[model samples]
Target: MKSSVRAVLGLAGGALAGLALMAASASAQTIAITDGRILTGSGIIENGTVIIRDGRIAAVGASVPVPAGAEVISAAGRVVAPGFVAVDSGLGGNEVSSQPEANDLRQSSNSISAAFDLSWGLDPWSITLPVARLGGVTRAIVVPSHPGSSGGHDHNHDFAGLGASGHHEPGLFAGQAAVIHLAEGTEIIVQPRVAMVAPFGNAGANVAGGARGALYTLLRETFAEVRLYARNRAAYDRGDVRALSLSRADLEALVPVVEGRMPLIVTVHKANDILMALRIAREENIRLILDGAEEGWMVADQIAAANVPVLLNALANLPGSFERRASSLENAARLHAAGVLIAIKGNEGSVHRAREARYNAGNAVAHGLPYEAGIAALTVNPARIFGQQQRFGAIAPGLEADVVIWSGDPLEPLSQPVAIYIRGVAQPLYSRGLELRDRYRPGQQPGLPPAYRN
Candidate 1:
C-alpha cells in the first residue's frame, strides 16, 4: 500500500508565493532524512541519513551524526532517491495546447528559428509543473519541436489541420531548448540553449520537401554556413556574404552547436537515419543526443561506438509507424547493455506527459532494464549529458536537494511520491485536478452549478 502524497501547496493561487516563503525559511534550516533506503544513483546506502543544509545536501552516509537544531524526518520503511529528471518536455511552456497564445513551445512560422530561445516563454505557474513535481520530477529539459513534425498522439487534436507548409519555409533547424529546475520559485531555467533541435525522419520529410534526404542535406548546408559565418564574421557583416539561407543571428546561435559546446538533439527514429545522424555528429565534431531513435536497438553497437547518448520513450514498444517498426520493449536494456547512456524521455509531441517519466522508468525496469539503470536514466544520466552534473542529479553531499521519498519501490507502478523536495525545500502535491475535485465536491452547493459553488 502507498501513502498519500504530501499536499504542501495550499488550495489557492497565492500558494506559490507561500511556497517561495517556505523555501526562504527552509533555506536557513538544516533538514535530515534519516534511516531511509537511499538510492544514491551510483549505488544504494542502506538505512542512510541524508542531511541537507542551505538548500544542498550537506552529508550522505549510513551513520552521519544528526546536527543540533536539524529538522529530522525518519523514513523508517520508505525509499529515498533523487527526484526524476524529465529530459525532454514542454514543461515551462504549452500550458494550454488549444490556446495558441498560451503555448510557446514551437514556432512553425519559420523553419530557421535557432535564435528562438524557449526560456523567455517559461511559465513557472503552469498547472503542469506542480503535477509533475508531485510525480517526483524535480528537473526538466523543456524542448521545442518542429512545427509540422508528426509525433506524439494528439488526442485532443490541439494541432489539428495545422500543416507546416503555410507561409513558413520548411527548413531544418527548429530552435533552442532550455534546462529547467522545478523548484518552488519563478526562476526555473537552469541553462538556456543547452541544445539546438532538428528533425530527421518522416517529420523531417514533411518539413524539408517530400524526402528525408533533403532534411539531411539542408541541415548539413546550414552547418556549413555556420562554419563559414564563424570564420568570416567581419566580411558577412559588411554585406560581403557567401551563400547563406540562415540569418546571422541563427548562425551565431549555432556556433556553440557546431563547436561541441552545445549538443544537437536530432529527432531520428529509423536505424538508417540514426546511422546518418551519427556520421554527421562525427564529421561535424559536435556532441549528439539522439531523440526519438525508435529503431536504436537495431544498431546499438554503432550508437555506442559513436559515444552518443540516446533519449527514448522507454514504453514505446508497439509499432506506431514504419519508422518505429523495430521498436522493442527491451530497447533501453539492449542499448544500456551495448554501453550507451540511456535517458528516459516522454512521449513525442505531448507536453503534458512529463510526469509519466517515472512510470516510463518503471516500464523499462519491468522489461529487463536494470532498476538502478532505470533510475539513473531519469537522474544522473540526463544531468551528466546536459552538463548540469555539479548542480543537479544524485543524492550525494554538496548536490542540490532534489530528492523524493516514495511509498514503495519507485519503479513500481503502484508506488508514488509520498514526499518530494527540490533544492532542499518540500514541494506541493497540489494540481488542477485536485483543485477541481475539491471545488466541485458533491452536495457542497445543491442549488448552484459546480462552477458557482467555489
Candidate 2:
C-alpha cells in the first residue's frame, strides 16, 4: 500500500511540473502581425510583417518572415502604428478628483515640495488605465496639479537652520513627475523623477507674491540655495551652514534640476512667459519642457532655436485667460513648421479621459499640421521628450512591442483600436465602463435593484 501511494505522489508531482513548463512556454510565445499598413514614425510601409519576440520587435519589413510556432495576427485592412504616449496625465494618481481618498495628484500643506515623488501614490489597478489602453495610449508622463494648498500653511519650524518662511513657500516646486506604462498588472512605473514640475505664469505668480517677476526671483534664489546645499551637504546636515529657505528634502530634490540631470516641466502659456522659461533654462543650465504653451506659436522660432520641446492641448484655441489670449488651433502647426518638437496633451486634466489626446492630434492635422507629424506628436515626440524614445516610441526593429492595430485612420473620432500589444503581450480590450453599460443596458433586467446587483 505504501509503495502504491508513493507511485501516485510521484506521478502527481511530475504532472504539475509539466503544466508549469507548458505555462512558461505559452508566455514566451512569439507574435507576428502580417500585411498591415505600418506607420514606422520615420516613414510608412504599405504592407509589412512585424515580428515580436521576448517583448521586443525582432523584425519589421514588407517581406519579413514569421517564425514557426508564433501566434499570427492578420492586419490586412488595418492600421498598425506605435502606441500613443500621453503627457500631463494624472493616471494612477487619482480616480476621482473630488474624492480625497482616490486622489493623489496634489499635496496640500506638505512641507516637502520637489521631493515628493508621485510614483508612491500610483495604483496599478486604476480603472482609468484600461480605458486609456483601449485608446492606444501605452505610456504617459504624469504630473502634479500643484504641491501646496490654495490656502498657505505656516512653516515656522526649522530643520538644520533651514528657514520656514519667505522663499521656502510651499507652491514653488510642485513635485517630481513620473513616466509610467499603462499596461495592466503590478509593474506600472517606468521611471520616477523623470522631471520636476514647476508651476509658472498667472497662478504661479499669484503664489509668489502676485508678480511674475517675483516668481522668477524666487526661482533664481532657490537655485542658488540648491547649489549651496549641494556643495556643503555635510555642513547643512550638521546645522553649521547658513539658514536657507527650503527644507532638506526639497533641497535634495532640486539638486538634480540645478545640476542639469533632470528636466523641468514649466507650466507657462503666454509667448512672453514661454521666452522667460527659455531664459531661465539657459541661465540655470538645466533642461526644460514647456507645458500649456497656449501662445507658443508666437515664439515658434525662438523655441525651436533653443531646441526645447513643447507639450500642448491642440484644442486650446480660446482665450481662456490673459496669458492665453494668443491661443490658436494652429499653435501646433506653427510650432511644427518652425521645427519645434511638440507633443499633444489630453482633453481631461487627469487620466480618466486621456484617450482624447488622439483626437487633439487630429484637430492639429486639420489646422495645417501634416498627417504624419500629428501621429509623431502623439507617439514619438512625448517618448523622446521624456527620454523613452529608444524603448517603445516608434514601430521599429529592436523597440519594445507596444504596437496597436487600428480599425481605420487612428486619428478619426470614430476609429477604434482592434488590438493592443504592450511588451509584446496582447491586452484585453476591456474597461469598467463597458461592464457598467452592459449591466445597465436598456433591455437587461436584474433580479435585484441596480445598486444591490453584483
Candidate 3:
C-alpha cells in the first residue's frame, strides 16, 4: 500500500514463479506464496506467506506455516495483495467497438431491454482477459453501455447553458451487470446480475421531459408499476395487468431492485441531483449506488450520512458539462476525507482500459487521497459496495485466493505483476497482445536492437 516504497522483485529463475506462470491452471496440490508484502485491504502485513488450498486462502500472515506437500512459490521482494477489481467494464463482450463482427453487444438503442444480460455475450477467451490478469486485475464487473453517457447524444444545452445538457432517449436503461474472474478458460461469470442500471441527472432529465422534477416522477411511477405488477402476477397472466411504459420482461428484471436484493446504480452528477437521488432511495427504501458523480465533492457529507457509495472515474477532473462544473482532481480525496465510501471505475468499451484502475488510484493519491485509501478504492471498496467482499476483495484466511504479486508499486504503469492468482490457482502469464509484440518485432534474421530482437 506504500506507493513511495520500492519493491524488490527477484525473478531471474523463480522456479516456483515459473511454475506458477507456466502451469497456473487448476491443480490438486496445495499452494504457498511466501515472502511478499501483503495488503489485506483491512491492513498490511510485511513479508507474508499466504497459503492456499482448494480454491480458498487457508492461512495468511508473516509467520504462517506452509502446509506439507505445498507447491511453494516465493514472492520475495514483491508486493502481494488482493487482485484489483474494475467496476463497470465492457470487457469480454467485445474486442473492438467499431468492428461489427468483433463486438457482440448492441449500443445506442432508444429503449434497451432491462433484462438484456451481458453474460451471454461474453467471450471467455478474449485476448484482453489475460492482459488484464497480467496487470494484476483478477475480478471485473462487465456492464453494457449506460444509456445516459454524454458521449453519443446531443447535449440538452438550452437549460441556462451551464454546460449541462438534459438530453436522453426515452426509456433507455442499460442491461444488468455481471461479475467475472479474469482467469483463463471458461465459466467467466460468477454473479450474473449484481445491480439494475439506470440514468439520472441531465441524462434522466432529458429522457423525462427536460427537468429534474419530471425525471424523479418518472422513476417513482416506474417503481410503482413494477410493484403493482409483482403483486398482481396472476392478474397479469390473465391479461389483467395494469398498463405500464416498460415491458413485462423489463419490469420483472427490476423486481430485485425494489425488494432490496439488488442495488440500482444511477449515473448522475450535480449536487442537487445527487441529493434528490438519495431522497428517492430513502422514500422507496431501496438500495442505491451513485456513478459518474463529478460534483460529488459538494455533497460528500450527505453521501456519507446516507451510507451510500460512489463509483467514479478518478481521472475525471474537468468539467465536461454544466452539471459537473465542480469536478476536480481532489474530488476523491474530498469524499474520503468526509467519510464517504468511494470506488474507482474505468473506461468502458469493447477494448476496455479497466485495468487502469490502479493507475487511476495513483492519480487520486497524487491529488491528496491517502495511498492506502487509493488501494482500497481499487480492491475492497467496490467489492463491499457490490456485495462481493466475502470472496473477492481481501487476502484473509478463508477468502478466495485472488491475489497478485507486483514487480513494483502497483500504481506505477511501469511496473507489472510477476504472478497472478484467481480462486487459489495461479493464472497463465501469456496474452495475445504479448504474442503479437513478439511476432511483430523489427528484427528476425539478425539483431537490429535489443528492443527489436526475437
| Candidate 2 lDDT over residue span 1-454, tens digit each | 1111011112224334323323432455677778889987767898898888888989999999778767666777778999999898888888976676787877754467788898999899999899898788998888876622211112332111222454455558788889899876898999999999877887667667768898899899989999999999999989999998777888999999999999999888989989999999998898999988989999999999999999999999998778899899999999999999999978767477789999999999999999999999999888899998889889898898889878788899887876777887767666899778868767677785877445
Report the number of the highest-lDDT candidate: 2
How good is model 3 by TM-score?
0.88
TM-scores for all candidates: the values are 0.88, 0.89, 0.88
- Order of models, best lDDT first: 2, 1, 3
Q: Quick one: RMSD of model 2?
A: 8.7
Please give the RMSD to the true structure for each candidate, in Å. 5.5, 8.7, 6.1
* Each model's lDDT: 0.78, 0.80, 0.76
lDDT of predicted model 2: 0.80
lDDT of 1: 0.78
Q: What is the lDDT of residue 184 in candidate 3?
A: 73
Which 10 residues in a row give candidate 2 its minimum summed lDDT? 1-10
Q: Tens-digit lDDT track for model 1 on 16-51?
A: 633543554364478777888999988899999888
